[model samples]
Target: MHAHIALDGPAGTLRVTGAGLPAVELVRAPGTPADAHTPIGTRRAALLTLTVDGAPAVIRPARGRLLRRSYRVDVRVGGHRYRLVPCSYGESRLSRDGRRIGTLESSGDGRVSDAWDAGPTPLDLAVGTALAAAFGTGAAPWWETVGDIVGELVAP
Candidate 1:
C-alpha cells in the first residue's frame, strides 16, 4: 500500500491519507523538543501520538548509538511493535520482528511518502506514516558534530 503524509508546521500536526487506511492525524506531544537536539539516546526525545481504529498509538525515540546522526523511534499500535531505522538522506526502513515490512521516503518539504508490503495491516500503515512525518530526512545532531571534531583531534 502507498500513503502520503502532509505536515502542518505551525500547528505541529501531521495528517496521513492512503487507499486502505483511515486518515490518521498525529499531534506532536506538548513540550517535546525538536529532534535536532533530542536525537536518539538523549534524555529528551521527540514524541508523536495518534489514534488508529479507535486505539491510540505512540511514536517515540528508541535507544540508539550515542554518536550516530540518524533518528530511531519505537512505534506501538494495535498490540504490535515496530522500529523505524533512518539512513542517510531521506530514506528509512520499517521493520517488525527483524524483518523489513516497508520503506518511507521524505522529500524534506513537509511531505513524506511510504510503501508497505502486503503483510502490514492498516494500523501498521498509520504508524509508519506518523514515523516518517515526525522524523523527516535525518540530519546530524549538534553534539554529533562536536563529537566528530573531538575524535578527529585525538586521532594519531
Candidate 2:
C-alpha cells in the first residue's frame, strides 16, 4: 500500500498524477501567487491550510532574487501540524512535533514514494500526501495513502 507519484513534463508548475488520485493542479493558471490557490485533487479535502517555505529546488530565481530553496512544507488539519523537512537528497521526513510519522522518498525517475504508520487517520494521510505535492514530490493517489494507513492499522 505505497504511493508512487511522478511529475510529468517540465518544472515550474505543480502537475502530478498517480494511482488513486486524479491529476493535481497545485497552482492557478499563471501570473498568480504560488500559494494563492488551494490544491485540487481526488480525495483532497479535510486539508485546512497548506503553507510552503524554502524552495524545494536548489536555485529558484524569483523577483530578481536568486534564492536557494529547501522544501519545508507545513500542513495543518484539526489543529495538528504535519511538517515535511528535507532530510537528505531524495528524501523528506514527515513528522509531528519531532516525532516520525512518515517519509516521502524520491526515486531515480522522479517518482515519489510515500509511507506512513498506523497512527495517522485517513485525513492525516490525505494531508500528508498533499504535503508531498506542496513541497515538491508531486501528488500521489488517494487510495495509496488510505491503503497504507489501513494496512498499518491491520498489521500486527
Each candidate's TM vs. the true structure?
Answer: 0.66, 0.44
Candidate 2 on 46-94: residue-level lDDT in tens? 3222222321211111111111123455544455666666555456677
lDDT of each: 0.63, 0.44
Which residue pairs clash within candidate 2? Answer: 55-69
Runs of candidate 1 exceeding 4 Å displacement: 30-47, 63-70, 115-120, 138-156
lDDT of 1 by residue, 67-129 (tens): 333367776666677888765445778887667898887654556677676567776777777
Per-residue error (Å), model 2, residue 30: 4.4
Worst 10 residues of 1 by lDDT: 36-45
Which residue pairs of candidate 1 clash?
none
